[model samples]
Target: MDLVIGRSRSAAARRRREVAERRTRAIAAAAGVTTGAVLVAEVLRVWRRGDAPLPGETEDVVLAAEQAIGQTVEVAVAGYKGGSTRENALLNLHLSFLATFVLTRVSTRLLRERGRWGPLRNVVVGDHHIHHFVPGIAMAFLAGGVSIVSRDEDLDPYLAVPFGAGVALTLDESALLLKLDDVYWSEEGIVSVQITLATLAMLSALALALRVLRRGEAEVLEHDHEIGHGMPGMVVPVPSFP
Candidate 1:
């Protein structure tokens, strides 16, 4: 009798897993199709707009988006004193990581609450549940590897986006890793939030410090240059012999 009950339980568990896997596959397929469609649409739009100004009401929307993005870039560059490709890349990475983390947290919360995100939930395979960190690790490694091998400085910022996103994903589950089990949605998961906040604070402080240092250096250099060139209205000090 006990054997039969055990078998029944196993069968029910298998069925539930199968249903979850099916839902996961459906969600993945839909996402892929949507992403492909958007990419194709963007490509066609850009191709059609080549060397020509956008006309009509669409122009307003496009210009608005472009302006917003441009302003964001300008702000980041100014804040980080991003005068070089590497500095710009780091700034982009920092912004991307923070944005990804915020989005991830919101998505997870929605899923937990069974909100409007239909058919998208935890990924389960057989008896084990796959976490976001798995893909996060893979993405981080891939981005890091590409950045290491690529010689183009222009590509660094692009790579940094994905690398930052991956790191954010991984760090979002830091508490799970620390506990060696899923503590997400539990009180213990608060630790992950704390860690993420701490990291952001540290990075922000470091960037501010670096910017201050660079600005001071530039000012000193400029002052010295003016003194060396003997610019008008500039005073120079000379040593007096005793």
Candidate 2:
């Protein structure tokens, strides 16, 4: 069963820019994700290729060797490696935003219906209420914001700020949950002293976000049958902009 509201915000005569802004925000977030992926890939590629040590390498090489340690200028003419511009950063960010959104919003519903997780097992079996862990609103905002500010190479500042904030908040929220549940200390806790149970919640939320995205996409395919029968599209038009 799909839900169709009214016309999309675009139809209204006012606040045209806000509609466009939402699209832009999604772009920025997508770009940030792309940047992160690209950076990690580059790092791994360089690491695997056995690029020479960064600089001033010694036996006890943990952080002791500074760039200025030997006044080192090893001139082999092999220029440093890095890329300043990547393709469709914002568009990728928007894609990521949607991907995450579906994972959180859609998949959670399916799991709950299928009785996969405990909290929603019969309705779910446990009390985790895992959906709460997914940063739905925030994802929507950052993903949306990316497009709004794409003109400024938003991957760094806007995306990073929220990503940092999200991490901090996730940690804090996990801490609060553990404390509230009175499960802070236990035999299980002792076994995994370094990692908290909160992390499990985080993983569950991420899983939910991913699954929903897949299912939603599938459903979109199924919805093709309804389009011309006086039925709405998979994505309904919201009439809130104006």
Candidate 3:
């Protein structure tokens, strides 16, 4: 009789687990579909716009939005040094990566708390919990591989967005990867936050330095141009330093 009861309890537990897994998967699928649909709609709308003016109030709103975005970008990048296309793409990647990391961390914390934060929850399947880092690695790999294969400068900005997002996702769980165990939510998980902040600081500093260097170069070149134009028919001697 006890044995039969034990078996029944075990079966009940397994069913519960299975149900939870299914719920988690369903939630994830729904979120993914919704996000994809929104992205596609936005992309199509923008593509259709293609330099065409919107009607009346809509046109004014769109123009205002564009100007606001431009101003924000300029402020974010320290007065906008007028970087090359590739440099701007790189900046976008860094900013996107940082933003994604922050959002992922917040989302995970909300899910962990089991709050009424929609259907967000940890994904599990057959006694295995799938970490976000898995998808992150795959995304980063695919984006990087395509970028390398295509070798197209024009496509860098597009590829960089996904690459940045993937990197952020993976790094958000850096502690787990380093320890080879699920250390998230533990003391060890703090390492991941530390690493992320350090990375952000380094990237921000590097970007600022690059901008300063570019600005200095531009000033020097402008001065040289002024001097050259001011003294016509004068050949400037090249200075040699041993």
Per-residue lDDT tens digits of candidate 3, residues 63-179?
655644443333334423455667766766776787787678778878878743676677889999889999899989999999899999878878888998898888888889988
Candidate 2 lDDT tens digits, 26-106: 654565575566445433333332323443445644333332222111110111011122222322333343344334334
Better of 2 and 3 by lDDT: 3
Whole-model Cα lDDT per candidate?
0.65, 0.39, 0.65
* After superposition, candidate 3 runs with Cα above 4 Å error: 1-82, 195-242
lDDT of 1 by residue, 20-138 (tens): 55654564466447546644553344324332234444657576456444433333344455356787687667767877876787788797788446666888899987888998898
Q: Cα-based RMSD of the predictions, in order? A: 15.7, 27.7, 15.4
Give each model a TM-score.
Answer: 0.51, 0.22, 0.52
Query: Which 10 consecutive positions of candidate 3 have the poorest summed lDDT?
Result: 43-52
Superposed by TM-score, candidate 2 places the C-alpha of residue 197 at a distance from the truth, in angstroms, of 10
Deviation (Å) of 133 in candidate 1 = 0.3
Question: What's the CA error at residue 209 for candidate 2, in Å?
Answer: 28
Candidate 2, residue 143: the lDDT equals 45
Clashes of each: 0, 36, 0
